[model samples]
Structure formats: structure tokens, C-alpha cells
Target chain A: MIWNERIECATRDEMRIIQSERLSETVKRIYHSVPYYRKKMQDAGLTPNDIEDIDDLRKLPFTTKIDLRDNYPFGLFTVPMSEIVRLHASSGTTGKPTVVGYTRKDIQMWAEVVTRSLCMAGVHRNDIVQIAYGYGLFTGGLGLHYGTENLGASVIPISGGNTTKQIQLMEDFGSSVLCCTPSYALNIAEVIKEMKVDISKLKLRVGIFGAEPWSEAMRKEIESKLKIKAIDIYGLSEIVGPGVSCECEEQCGMHINEDHFLPEVIDPETLEPVAPGEIGELVFSTITKEGLPLLRYRTRDLTRLHYEECACGRTLVRMEKCKGRSDDMLIIRGVNVFPSQIETVLLNMSEVEPHYLIIIDREGTLDTMSLMVEVQEQFFSDEIRKLQELRIKITKQLESVLGISVNVKLVEPKTIERTAGKAKRVIDNRSI
Target chain B: MLIKQLSVFLENKSGRLTEVSKILGDCGINMLAFSVADTSEFGILRLIVSDPERACKVLHDNDFSVNLTEVVCMNCPNEPGALAKALQILSDNQITIAYLYAFSTGDSANVVLKPDQLEECIKVLQEHKMELIEASTLYKI
Candidate 1:
């Protein structure tokens, strides 16, 4: 079931040679085209000539989200706007987004990688692929869309939401493959139950779910509920999207598309590379991206990379599913949520105190966020209706901002624990 | 008059009620009345004690979600029809009782009820010539 067997089943030395040539060329290109990267290299007292191979990649300074944010809109693009054909952005620390641009070649490369990913999930030319990922500024939807097409499969470009219609199309179109976030897959399963649609009627045989971290238990739930093989795919907007790596049929670990993107795990605190099979923050170097070429970009996603050959016969390096993040970012239902984002919503409202605690838990297969906020002394009321209204107001504001429903609990003033140092913001009890 | 009632939240677990009672007993807080309101998962144990503030402090120190609420306590005659007459007055006045528990002491039955409208319930009971037990006398009894 290995896709692109020539590349995927390459020997360790062969991958290094391919990675080395690509990395050297990418370094030289960025050093010449992007001043930000040139400055970082110059600051490190290095030149493109200093990086002769993939081993010299460590000599280059690591790029971070903050660096991306500092660059803002198109500052990171290596090519002119005329050459860039597409753009995708994920949420940044502030209101602005971390932007990525893609040239035509880059788009084709994305399609190829994702095609390999879909093929790894056992999808083929005859399979009717359903792209449920959102198709807008986010890269998940269109990334999978073109990739399914590139794989010579019949693709249904049905973007996310409209659960009822999605089910109808799944039945009528005989969609054999589904692509979306794991949580959205669960949401679809829920809607399917409510609609009472006969699962047997649908031809769904496999689901390639990603765009957020998920657990084995969640995979089992999705598999049993949808009666399909639930496969975990890994990608982020920074280094392509939804196709950087995916699980082969063996399902042990996701095979990283090392030819297009290079992954390195490092201790987030020490900035030192970790041994293989050790968990650390994931960093990527998009050696093949034409528009936006990143070198040693810190993704902040923590996971372990395994070099052992998989049963699927892919000699490419496989990474365990991301365990968690090295930062304070929280993913709720596939949407990134920062406690500071919740803080911004609370501080904007006048009736509540600034103190809040975010509690995240797993209710069955879905993740739930419950925010406990303290009420101001003047705004506190004995009336249950008034308190409920305040809770609703907070919930609505948070939902609008975070793009996920939140349960808000308004407590008495000073009910939230006060800490002299950094306040504890999130309490995650999920076993995942 | 309003009596201070201690409401302690308890997870529905074995020995949770026993733990609360033990804490109160160890603190030497005499419980005059106790009742439990529960669903399947959790329960609220409501107690009228000799020293409610101290009992609340002890329970809270033990990590219980404790709150002090005002409940109205009135004496009903120790007869079958006596309770119905007092309830009819509340029903006629459109006052809803959140919960109620009764205990007999000294030939009279004491009915401690948490009404939806505490102030209105007191006023209605006073107009109906019902003897409302103040916290001081009720604690001693």
C-alpha cells in the first residue's frame, strides 16, 4: 500500500542524499531571495556555502512563529506575488494570521504529497474522495481537494459543514474516502446518527482525518461509528497542509514525506536535537516549497520520529502522532484556542472580572471546553436569570472569537485561585 | 426571621455524607436538622446547625463547596392537618417551596423550608398568624 515506493522506500542514505541536495538548494535560494532569512544566516555568521548538506542545517538559526509574525503578510515569501499562485494562513498569537504563499509548482508539489498521503490511506483512482476540510483561507480543504484529484481519484469538493447534505452526498455519490479533521469526522458521525441514515448504504471505506491532534481511542471510535478505516494524517499550514505526512496501512506511525519537507525533533528548552524515538518539539524545513521556503521552522508540535522500517514497507521516517504542544495553545474541536484569547474576550466584557480558568475535558470522543470566570462584585446578582444571562453573554462572545462553543460558569468574586506568579490558565484532563 | 442553612455539595460517592457528618461532629457543631437533595451523580446536603458559620468554615476547609443560604423555619402543630393548612397558605400566596424538611420536638413539629421568595414567605407566614422560629430559639431547640 506504499505510495511513491521509489521515494517512500528509499534507504536512509538515499533520503539523506536527496534531502541534502534539496536543503542546500533551498538554503541558497532563501539566502538570495528573502532578506529575513539572509539576515538570520548573516547573524549566525554563516552563508549558503556553509550549509553543504542536511547536516549543516543545524548551523542555520531556527525560525519561529514569532519570526513569522514579525514578518507579517508576505514578508516570508521567497517569490514575487506574480509567481505566487495561492495563499493560506492560520491563526497567529495576535489577531493577525501567519501567512504562507504557494507558487504553481508548490501547489503541484502539495498535490503530489497529499496524493501520496491519500494513497497511503489505501485510496486509489477508482475511489470517490470526499473533501470535508474547509476550502477557504485554511489549507486543509483545498489541499486535500487537489491532492485527491491528482491521485486520479474522483473527488467531491464538499467543504465542511452542512452535515445533512454531506451525508446525503456521501450516500448518493458513493464517496469511499473522507477527508477532514478528526473532530469534524466525529461531528459527522453524530449528525449521521441523528439523521438515522443507513450507514451500509454509504460506500465510505476509509477516512483520512487530520488538521488536529487525535488519540487512538478517538480513532477506534471513528472507525466503529463510520464503519471505515480511520487513518491519522499530519500537517500544518506553515509547512504545506494536511499532506506533509500520513499513516500507511500498517497504522503504526505516520510516514513523513521527507523529500518535500524535512522534520527534526528538538528539546524546546535547550534547542538541542533529540534522539530518534524521543518526544520533542517538531520542526520542519520545507526544502521543496517555491513561494515560501522555511529553514528550521519550529512548529511547536511535540512528537517522536521513528526511523525503523514500517510494515507497509516505507523506509521513510515515521513520526508518532503529536503528543501535545510545547506552548500554551489549546486545540478545541480542531480550532486553536489560546487562554489569552479567552482572556481578551473576558476583558472586553465589562460585567466580569479579569480572572478566568479554562477546563478542557473529553466527553466521549469529542473535546469540551468549560470556562470558569469570576464575576465582578458590582455585577454579582442573586437572581439566577441574571447570572444565566451573564454566562450566556460570556459564552457567546467566546464562541464568536474562538469559533467553538464554550460552557461558561460565572462564580463569586475571587473564586478563581490567585497566583502571585503566572496564573494557571488551563486544566486539561483529557487522557489523549 | 431567617435561619442560616448550610448547603454542602457532595459527589455521589460512598462515605461522602459520613465524612461531612464526621467533620461537623468533630467540630462540635450540633446539627438541628439535615436533609439531602440529590440527582444520580451528585447531591446537596442541607443542614441547620447550632453554629452554621463555623460548620461552613470546617466543611470548606475540608474542600467542600459550601454556601450559606437563608431558609425560613416555622412551627407546625403536631397533627396531620396542621401541615396542609400552612402549605395551603403558601400555595394561595403563590409562594413556591424549593425544599422542606420536618422534625418533631416538644409537642410541636418544626418545618424548615427554603422558599423561592424568602422575604415574601416570611411576610405571608406572619400575616397568617404562624409563629416563625427565630435562629436563636431554633438553634437551642
Candidate 2:
């Protein structure tokens, strides 16, 4: 079920040529139409002519989230307002969101890539996809919606939340495919069990889960609970939401649509490209995007890329599941820790639920990290000593893995807040 | 010989106890006997309620972590050495009481005991002719 096989199955040489030609055009367009990009290029003493091929990507200055914020709304858009047909923005926790625009052709291109992403996951024209990702300002909802429609599949565009309705529609519509964040999928599974719905009666077969990084252990949990094959799809709103790459049925790694979105992994400290297949921060260059053709945008997502062709017969470069976002990496007691590492450890244990919260605070110049975990109901004991022993066991494991002592606090089940979108796992109280 | 006790997990904070009491009070669930084991971080609120099953359900509905545990409830004379004599019987038989709490009513006191060996502790107490309160009678009171 390889959609757009001509580009998806292109050889390395073929992809390189396609990428080089598109990248050259994208660079020239931004340099001429975007003052921000033109000034950035001028400051770097580089011209659009210098970017002759994909290899010349290093010559251009990197675009970061801060740069997008500084430009604000429509500052970096290459096309005029008349040409921009749609806009989607990623919500910023502190201030204004990062806005991205798309022309009519751009939207069509988005749908094409997303359609290819769905096909990679084994979805076809006959399958009904229930898109549970949040709609509106976020790109996940509409991004997946158009793609599902583009694939000629039936789409139940019932956006996020309203768990009961989601389940009802799932049962009524006989949706064969599901799309949403991994956390929301877990929440749906929990609700289904609570409602005593017989999952066998549901026709769901495959799930395309993304928008946030999830662990392999979580994938297993979702698979066993929902009785469906959960495929990981990776994308951010900044560089054409959720269709930048997606895992094929092979399930080894996500195949990046490199012909359209050129991928690079670089060391955050030195900004130099990491050796092939090495873990580093991911950067993207929109090769064929029109409305918002970014040069080299630092995605801040950390992952490694595999150049070998996948068993699924797609020669698109595959990226490992994101380890964690570099921005989410916390430096506590001078030790760099990612919430995903703690998530991996928690998911491995059978006595605790996957829900957890990491709280970091400063006391008298000493940094402290306290983890609150919920004990499984079956594991709860009337005796305090037994519960205390479980706490100590968790603390010891975390200390050994994190190389820093962590205060483990045992909370009751459902104590941690669950969201329909990304789960907030860390709370840093330290002002500095 | 065996009674159900509702044990709840409460984080150490102001008004948490009030919240639990309010939930039970609103439902007309009476607390027969109760105890709280506290730490700096959290507290375990152990309670003997008139309706254990209903109380557990209501508390759970209110998002409180409540569990039903089996404990031995015995009636002891409301006088000095009465509790000690009953406890001495279990101590003599090498049966350990993990924790115990009591509430006095009229001439007798109702004592709830959670022992390391529940069945063995009940057997030892019955052999010694200690009057154990029936769960039904305790709930009625």
C-alpha cells in the first residue's frame, strides 16, 4: 500500500537530486521575498546562489523557535497575504504562539504528504479514520483531517475530548483507523474499560499516534489494551504538522518525507551535523514549501536518522522515535535529565501506573527532584511498611538510573492530571 | 470477630480532613471509630464507618483514595488493665498486633485491632473467651 511510490521509493541518488533542486528554489524564494530571511542570510554573508544543492544547507543560518517568535505573525511568510490561504499556530506556554501559513497549493501539498503518511501505516480508501487529535488553532486536527480525506478514506472528524462520544462513534462508525496522541489513546482505553465496553465489538485495527514523544513500552501498553497496532507518526506545526514523517507497517522507524522536508541531525552545543545515525537535535529545511519556505529550522526534537532503506520498501530516511525534546531536558543538580528517561523506568515497573509527575525545587541552594507516582490498586496495602518499601524500591531504581537521588512520593491512583493532548510531566518550581 | 475499616490516603495539607469528613457527612455515613497515621508528606486516615461498602464507594466517587481492610474488633471492659489483659493474651501466644485504636461506649470500649496474622489473632482471642463485637452490631451502634 505504498502511496506515491515514485517519490517514496526513490533511490538515494534520486532523492538527493530532487532535494537539491527543491532546496535551491526554496532558498532563493525566501531570500527574495522574506525580509527576515533575507537579512538573516545577509548577516551570515551568504547568498541564495551559495545554496546550490542540499549539501549547501550548512551555509544558511539556522531558524529557531525564538526566531519565529521574534518575527511574530506573518513576519517570515514568503508569499503575500493574498496568496496565504490558511494559518495554523502552535500554542506557546508563556506568550504568543508560533504561526505558520499555507497557500492553496501548500495545503494540497500538506494533504499529499499526510495521505502518504496514512498509506505508510496501511490505511486505504476503504478504512474509516477517527481523528481524535484536537482541532482549531492546533495543526494536528486539520492537518490529519485533510490527509485522511485526501487518501479518499472516510474520516470521522470528531476532534479531541468527549471520551464517551469518541467511544460511541468508534463503535457505531466501525472506524478501522484511529489518530490521536498516545496519551489520549491511553485515556480512551481507560474510559472504555470503565464503561465495560467490549473492545472485540469495535472494528479498530490500526492507530496513528503522535504529536508527542512516547516510549516503546507505552506502545506495548496501548497495543495490548486497545488490541490494535499503534504506529508512531512524527511532525510539529512549525514545519508542516504530523506528516513530516511517519512509521510504515514495518514499524522499525519513522520514514521522513525527505524529498519535501530535508532532515538533518546536529549537535546542540556546536551546531554541527552529527555523524550518520547518531542521536542529536533534529533540523528541517522545507525543500518544496511555498507560503512558508523555511531554510534550516531547528525543531529542538532529539533523534537519530537511519539512511538504509526500510523493509517496507520505502527509501525515505527513517528517524528513530524521538528520545526527548532538547528544550524539555532539565539540568537538575547540574545533571541533565529528560522526563522520557523517567517515563521509561516507570512504564517498565508493574506495580505503578504510567501517570507520574516530576517536581523540582530549590532549597538553600540545593536542587531537589521529587517524583510523585501512583501505586496500582492491587499493590496497595493496609500496612504502611509495605507501601514504604515500594517507595524505597522506586527511589533506589531512579537513583541508579538518573545518577542523582530522587525523592519518591507515593500518591493514590488518578492523582496525576491527564490531558486530551500532551501530558505535562514536569513542574519546575525553582525560579532560576 | 472481623470488621471492615476504610483506610484513605490523604496528602498532608490543610482542609483535607475536612474534605473527607464533609463527603461522609453529606452522605449521612457515620464514622464509628477512626485514627490517622501521619508523615510529613501524607497521612493514612483509617476509619470504621456505619456502612463500609457505601462509604468506600462515595469516597472513591469524590476522588479520594479509599480502601476497605479487614480488622478484628473486640469489646473490652471500660477500665484500666482491661485492654492490657486482652493484649497480653495475644502477646503470650506470639501473635503481633500491628496497630490498634479504641473508642469508649458506656461501660465497655470497642477496640479495633489490625494484626499481622488476622485468623490466628482471632483464634487466640476467641480461645481466651474474649467477647468480640459482631460486625452487624458495630455498624448498628
**Predicted model with the maximum lDDT:** 2
lDDT of each: 0.86, 0.87
Model 2 CAPRI quality: incorrect
Count backbone clashes in candidate 2: 0
Candidate 2 lDDT, A116-222, residue by residue in tens: 99999999999999999888777888999999999899999999879899999999999999998876788889889989999999999999988766678879988
Write the residue-wise lDDT of candidate 1 on A362-408 in tens digits: 78657899987765534643333455677788888887777779988
Model 2 residue B141 CA deviation in Å: 44
List of chain A TM-scores, every candidate: 0.92, 0.78
* Fnat scores for every prediction: 0.00, 0.14
The collision pairs in model 2 are none
Q: Residue A54 deviation, candidate 2, in Å?
A: 0.9
Per-residue error (Å), model 2, residue A22: 0.5
Best-fitting candidate, measured by TM-score?
A: 1
Give the residue spans of candidate 1 off by over 4 A: A348-352, A378-393, B1-141
Residue pairs with backbone atoms closer than 3 Å in model 1 (clashes): none
Model 2, C-alpha of B29: deviation from truth (Å) = 42
